[model samples]
Target: MLIAFFTNNYKPFVGGVPIAIENTARMLRRRGHRVLIFAPDYDGDVQDEPDVFRVLSIKNFNNTPFSLPLPLTLRPAYDLDTLSQVDVVHVHHPFLLGMSGLQLARAYNLPVVFTYHTQYEKYIHYLPFPQQMTAELAIRLSTRFANSCDAVIAPSSDIRKTLIERGVQVPVHVLPTGVDLQKFRGGQKDFLRKKFNLSAETQIVLTVSRLAKEKNISFLIRAFVRLCTYNSQAVFVLVGRGDAEDDLKALARDLGIANRVYFAGELVGKELVSAYKGADVFVFASTTETQGLVVLESMACGVPPVVVDAPGVRDFVHPGVNGFMVPEDGEADFAERVLTLLDDEALRKALGAEALKTARRWSLRQTTSKLERIYKSLSAKGQPRGKRERFIMLRELISYQFEKLLEEVDKLF
Candidate 1:
């Protein structure tokens, strides 16, 4: 099958959404599908590849926090030209690029699939508008964007539920964003520790993510400070870059734990794998993830996680099994859980072993196979039966018409 994978960002730009697109494209290609990625071109020259296609020249929107690409124009000509050759179009976000993909899919009469990766509602606080009004507008836009697809994929049940609540009428599948198991599996812990300048006696707790506002890195800093109050030998390592770099540094100093914390910005490949393997525990406080890919990677490296019990994250970490899940804002509770893992070597080993086992369920191969099944299902359904027919059918599905009709006899109550 010819599949057009669309995204607002691509390689050299690191984030969960781009990683998902890359992994999906690679896996689908390996399975004998021709996958072409359609994305906006950044200032730097993107390598030309047989399957990768760049359609627009975009500019960097913000210099701080992170670099976001804003397209020079909203014209659909580029997308229509590239998407005309594909059997299916899979869009990876609800941004300008995704809208273009939706338009092209409509024009070509192709099946469209969408993966809802980010919670734009939570991100509204970062914008200049009133938070509630902005969130509402985002919800309306997201609903329309998702409804344009033949089916919508949600990385976690939490996200699926949110979409349904916002009146999305499409079929939603809970597919996890995956990890590279071989690269992250068991390895030389001592070598990694030494490479990071840590002695065997030091306890390492790590967090790998972009330092954005939604990540709530300040909470991690506070929790680390509390951890250090008891265990002075514990070290905190942060991997990844963002606008909050200096703010996080200043927070560490204010908390009086600057000496014990280290920020290793955006380590990838073997270095990133080593960082995961060497850590005794993984800590993440972010409430903005659609699915925290780093959590699974850490688990694959045999490192247990201490995460907040929030959307996207709840799908990965199971309390008392592989990791601990604390309340979203509970810094003390989070620190206490970390301390428990730090204090008990036997418990850590047991949990880490189980975590490795759990990580196997979310392999990239499995995710790709599930996606293939969805593609075949949509294809078998055939071209949509006109706009009105499609809209009525979608409304019936959303209204639970069959179930409602069956229960109508008992509605007097």
Candidate 2:
């Protein structure tokens, strides 16, 4: 089957969404299916992936890592013969290039499958409009887009429930981006000894996330400070960079644990694997994730995480079996859980072994096969969406594009 993916994020841009797209595309290709990606050009250089069609884009929009694609540039690609034969359209976002893909799917009369990848309402700080207004609009617009599709892929059961509450009438499947288990499980590395001049006896606690406010990173740091009060050898390491880095660093200094905290900004490839494997415990406080890919990665490396009890994280963790889940309101309890693992060698090793076993259940091969089945089932259907439904979807998408154009013009003046 020929499957096409339209996303606002892709390669050369390292983030959760791009990583998910890359993993899904690679796994599908390995399964004897053809996949094409329509994405924004990040570097304006020669294309690395032959199957990807680059749409003209504004790199690093509003000083953020995301690229703003010029949707008009995508029309010429639609004229290509190869694209015309695509069996299904998998859209990874609800706006921008997502709308362009919907237009393409409609013209070709193909099945459209939309994935709910992020909690857009949580990122309203990136928008120029008023917070409440933009957030409400985001929720409403995303729900309308989901309803416009033939089927929706929710990364977690929590997201599916939210969609139903918002009146999404289409078929909703709870499917998440799976972890590449081998990437971390292949080997072990003592990153703490190599990066810092720390001994093997030192207790290492690690967390990987963009140092953004929405991630609740400050909460993690405060919890880490509490752990430091009791364990002198325990050190906290953060493995990502974002706009809030300076503020977070200041917070650490104010709390007097500056020396105990290490900021390992933006690790990728082997460095990331080493960080996950070397740590005694993995900690996460983000409440906005659609799924906990990083937490799963940590588990694959045999690290047990004590994560904040939230919708996405709960799907992967079994309280006594693999990891601990602290309630969102229990910050002190969160620290206590991590301290429990850090101080006890036997219990930590027991949970760490179980974590690797748990991670295997959500491996890439398993998840991609499920995606293939869904595509085949959807493609077997006899007809496209109703004519009236297609017309309404197109009209709404065009109006959205026009409004975005006006905003770009308004910014120029």
Candidate 3:
């Protein structure tokens, strides 16, 4: 099968959506399928990648790392002839390239699949208006986009439930991005300790996230300060970098935990795996996750996470079995749970064992097979856009574009 993906961001940009797209495409190719990607061009992005297409874009928007794609027209980024042969059209965001994906599908009479990757409302701080206003606008636009698609892929059942509640008429599939078990397993346990030159007795509490506001890194830092009172050996090690790095570092320093916190920047491949393995416990407090891929990665490396209860996170966790899921609030409770795992090695190892088993169910090999089935199912029922369907889509596209313009204006005030 041939699949075409229209995504707003891609590799060298650093985010969950890009990782999901790249890994899924890799598995598809290995399974004897071809894939094409259309994404915004970023300034330091590696050139000449296979089966990838780039359109004009502002590499940074308002001093932020987000690239604003300027596709200019519905058919700007894709080739008419190549697009006609694609079996499926998959889109990762609900705007920009995502809108373009829907347009191409409508024009060519192809089945389009939309993935609900992020909780749109949580990250609307990047917009100019009050969060509530921008959030409402985000919901309306995303719901319309999902309704127009042949199918919507929700990374968790909770997200699917939310989509249904929001009046999404199309079928919603629960398909979380799976982990590569082989790549994550059996990482060198002493890797981080040796790299940072820490004593073996020192405990590492790790989190791999893009240090951003929506990630709730500030909350975690506060909780870590409280945790320090209980365990003198514990040190917080954060992986990944973002616009919020300076603020987070400042927070740690002000809280008098700067010496106890380590910013490891970003690590990938074997080093990333080792970082996961080196940690005694994985900690996270993000309430705005679609599916916490890093949680699964931590579990895959035999490090049980003490994460707060959130949408995508609630699906995989079995408290007292794989790992502990703290309440939505309360730093005291969150700290106590981490201390529980830290103080007891046997209990931590026992939970970590079950975590490895849980990780197996969502392996890349299994998820890829599920993806193939989804594609085939859609293809079986596929039909070209009839006159009526074309009319409806064309009208919806115009409305969507106008709404987008209104949003830009609203940002100013």
Q: What is the TM-score of each candidate against the true structure?
A: 0.88, 0.92, 0.92
Candidate 2 collision pairs: none
- Candidate 3, residue 29: Cα displacement in angstroms equals 0.9
List model 1 lDDT by residue over 12-66, tens digit each. 6778888888877888888999987777666666677776756555355534332
Question: How would you encode candidate 2's per-residue C-alpha lDDT over 255-309 as one tens digit per residue?
Answer: 9998988998888888889888889999998899999789999998889999998
lDDT of 2: 0.85
Local distance difference test, candidate 1:
0.80
- Model 1 residue runs over 4 Å out of place are 64-82, 125-130, 186-188, 381-413
Local error of candidate 2 at 115, Å?
Answer: 0.4
Top lDDT model: 3
Ordered by lDDT, highest first, the candidates read 3, 2, 1
lDDT of each: 0.80, 0.85, 0.86
RMSD of each: 6.6, 5.1, 4.1
Report how far residue 157 has shifted in candidate 1, in Å. Answer: 0.7
Error in Å for residue 216 of model 1: 0.9
